[model samples]
Target chain A: MKSPLSLEPLFHVGPAGITEPVVVSWAVIALLGLGSTLATRRLSVIPSKGQTLLELVVSTVDSQIRETMQADPAPFRALIGSIFLFTLVSNWSSLIPGIEPATAHIETDAAMALIVFVATIAWGVRTRGLRGYLATYAEPTWVMIPLNIVEQFTRTFSLIVRLFGNVMSGVFIIGIILTLAGLLVPIPLMALDLLTGAVQAYIFAVLATVFIGAAVGERHKPVAPSEKEP
Target chain B: MRIDWWTLGLQTINVLILVAILARFLFRPVIAIMDERRAAAAKMLGDAEAERAKAIAAREAAEAESGKIAASRDAVLREAAEAASAEREAALATAREEADQVRASAETEMRWARAAEESAASDRSARLAIDVARKLVARLPDSARVDGFIDGLARALASLPEASRDGFGAGERARLIAPRPLTAAELQAAHDAFARALGRPVDFAVVVEPAVIAGLEIETPHAVVRNSFRQDLKRIVEELTRHDGVHR
Candidate 1:
């Protein structure tokens, strides 16, 4: 078997290589897109159960964004919700035999982090002027510019590392246990892995909302109980 | 660690595309429909409130109209009662007046009828008195009654007005009316008594008139001396009739 840390190329398109993690990510995307289409296609004023579930997921995403970011969820809902769904589905894909979770790989996690980083800058520039966005680093004093600038990259890196470490550690530990013992031995660990995957998804989404909210410089909504402290 | 730049870029693109697709298909549509439903509910509530206000106004108007109608009806009833009362009073007054007129007419009729009866009784009494006087006169002694009448004529001639006495004395001839043919001695005695009372002799022609009853009537061209039962009875009858007419 290939190393868990490295993704072998599944195939090649001309000179470019198509890796297994990328293919898995495509499948996750396709699944999410198809679900979104089917769920919203027959929306009505009165709802059936399936439509109710769809609305519940959307409202829950909106609520999380509002509580965590302290801003209206309209501008941030798509990016944050997509990141959560992709991470959750990719991570939980490990339940299928011989299928490794995509987030267990560093490349997928880095890609999602990069997206959040770029989105933060883009939203900040759009919400405040470009000068205002750059000026955010000079909060407290001019001397903190270097530290604040470093913290921007460091925070994006932290978002990537946190999700990758949790998902990869669970996958690695489960793979080692499954190799050492039989599948039964890793069952509880696998359940714990599922829980870890869902948590990681939530953390990734919430961090993205926080980063974007800070960039936008608006706290329109009320904060949650846990976030009430500084 | 090995990183594939191509894979990182591809996944980023895929996530961005997914974000776009979900925003279009799910979030925006659901939120828009929710907004529409909320607006429709608010509009329906506003319309219901307006309708309730209209219903209340109409009910109040109906109540006011009912009150006005009741007031008008009471007024009409009062006016009608007043009119009926006036009509009743007028009818009673007219009836009382008619009754009073009928009673007065009856009283007048009774008085007239009584007067006529009394007048008739007076005539009958006068006629009876005259007949009785005539019977008494016929039963009297002829010589004595004739002498009494002669003395009455003397008394009447003495009481006469001077103009009447002169008119009697100047007469070419005086007429003597008696109830019957006087006796020659009664005639001579009456003539002498009248001449002695008048201080002049009055020539007389005797007339037998039973209508004089037993007394004698001496008359000249312009003067008269009536001393007869028939004249007395006639004067009494006239006075009774005049008195009865005044009563009527």
Candidate 2:
């Protein structure tokens, strides 16, 4: 008979049974906050090189807001930009020797996806006033309300699965390649891990913007011709 | 591997609390600072734009002031020129009036002096003539001949240029004849002037200036008439003297 692989406790938990991924996720968040704070310490009207890079990231998030929301985007500026930065760093955690990527686990991905889903619902209700937001589902036919309700749940599911699958796949592939090669031959696969980490972060942010945009439903059309007609 | 629901549920709750606390404490303050910075930048830009507008307005005002000063300067120059011309005209008028007064006084003095000298010379000549005449009357054959010669000499002295013509008998007279028609206005003015002088209108033929100059003479018929080039020349010369001071 073959022996099963013995799984030992990776690390100690606190009184509340906090696991490795939770601590690593917090660490990743702290690192991202520290990096962003240091980059923008001396905020200049004319940006220095480092601040320019930070500004480029912020403006990219702002542009995504402007495109997907089709409005001034003042509201989503901090929310989406912080999410992108945090996710990007956390997805890169496994590259370090002692730290595993929190996003590789379904629980971490679910927390991130839930943040996006709740934010999307809150913005939709805030912009469209609850009754109008619910009426969006009755479009094309009043009978399709149940299907529309399922769609909202499916969107949250898809967000969680997509992030979890991509991060988990990259980690598993790199682990398998290392086990087989056992040496420097696994370098290319680790390189791919870095690439996948960045790509996954971008995909999560983009999909979040799209889903939020769909829930918000066109945001009253910035400049409506009908309002000007009278 | 068996699923551990207790571990998963506890981890999810822990993560939610941590995220909420982090977002509230760290991210919120940082975002607020960023928004404040953005507002300050926009305010600075607005202030710069306002200052630029004020500067442009000031420049335009300066240019307008310059234009007004230039226009005022031109107006002052024009007024000065008008004042100068008025002064020159006034000076010329005063000079002309002074000259006319000097000429009138000079003429009056010469006339008085000439009258006194002529009276003295005439008295001496009359005395001499009287003595000579008395002697000649004594030597002559009849007193009537001496008296008649004295009368003839007196008439000659009175009409030195045309004494014989003046002595013509009442039966003899000169008349005028012309060859062309005259304008109605000229005829009417002449007739009106004559009627005013005579207290009654008279009929007369009107003639053109060319016909009178070419065909008429001074002694033509019942009255000695002067309607020819000689008369026209005299009238033109008299008019030129009045207008141009040639004879004055």
Candidate 3:
């Protein structure tokens, strides 16, 4: 069996080599773009079934953004919604024969985390001016600034690691079982992998919301004890 | 694990492109349509409420007009009832007056008819009594009764004054009316008796009149002596008619 950690290029282009995960991400982008276009082609006051489904997805994303970020969903909807969609689709791509899920690769997870890191700063700067954004690190005391700064990079690193580890480990475990026990024996594990992939996508999107919410302004209201994450 | 910086950059670019596509195509359009739908619903609700208020006002106006019409109808009915009552009363009074006049006329006619009937009956009775007396006198010796009536006629003539007796015996021929045709001897006897009573001779022409009912009457040129049962009955009937007239 091939190492799950190794990257192999199907083709090399001049000086740079394009790996499998990069190509798969392009496919995910094309699929989402095409689906979004077709779903939104003929919008009216009264919605068709496909249009309603798309609206439901958009509303759900908006609800999530509002609940997690304590802010309007409009500014963050594209970034957070795209991340979740891409990760979820990429993770589910494992069901396709001869296609590795892009999120199972560290490169894809890192790229998604890097986009979140950049968007967090941009949103924070837009919400509060640059100086105010910088001043947020010294929040209850100036003594916490260095720790807060390190916490930012570490959290982004954690997002990358968390997604890559869960997805890649599920892929590796299913691959190992398929190698040892044959194809049908790995079906249950693949199903678990699919579940794990969906959960990881949710976690990634929520964490992005939390990080962005913190940067822009936590604006956190008190939640009921029952509503708190246990 | 090995890092692929090239793959990372490409994936990042891909994700950004996806974000742009989804935001432009999916979220913006959907949210806009929802906003539009909400606005349209609100506008429809406002229009419906306005129409409902207009309908209510129209219904109320109709009810008000109906109430006024009902009141007018009641007034008209009241006036008609009063007019009808007055007309009925006047008609009843006129009918009563006409009935009373008819009754009075009928009563007057009845009284006159009763009086006339009574007069006819009395006349009939008198005639019947006269006829009965004639029949009775005929059953008796009529010649004997004629001598009594002749004596009554002589007495009536003797009661006259001398100048009246002379006038009675003088110019025109005198007539003697008898109840039956008298024989020549009776005629001569009546003439003698009449002449003796007058102290001058009276020429009395004899007349046979059964209507005298067994009595005699003497007539001269200017005077008459009535002495018969028919004359007596006529006198009694006249007195009774005079008394009846006075009572009336």
DockQ of each: 0.50, 0.07, 0.59
The regions of model 3 sitting more than 4 angstroms off are A1-3, A12-15, A218-230, B50-248
Evaluation by DockQ, superior candidate among 2 and 3: 3
Docking level of model 2: incorrect
Full ranking by lDDT: 1, 3, 2
Question: i-RMS values of the candidates, in order?
Answer: 1.3, 4.7, 1.2
Q: What's each prediction's TM-score?
A: 0.67, 0.60, 0.63
Considering TM-score, which of the candidate structures 1 and 3 is the better prediction for this target?
1
Candidate 3 chain B minimal-lDDT segment of 10 residues: B239-248
Task: In candidate 1, list every pair of residues with a backbone clash.
Answer: none
Give the CA lDDT, 0 to 100, for residue B99 in model 3.
82
Please report how far candidate 1 places residue B85 from its true position, in Å. 6.1
In order, candidate lDDTs are 0.85, 0.61, 0.84
Candidate 2 ranges with C-alpha deviation above 4 Å: A1-16, A36-47, A71-79, A121-135, A182-188, A218-230, B1-34, B95-248
In model 3, what are the clashing residue pairs, if there are any? none
Q: Mark the regions of model 1 whose C-alpha exceeds 4 Å error after superposition.
A: A67-70, A176-195, A219-230, B53-248
| Residue lDDT tens for model 2, A92-194 | 8777875667777776667767777788888888879899788878976999999988988898888878887888777777777777877777678778878
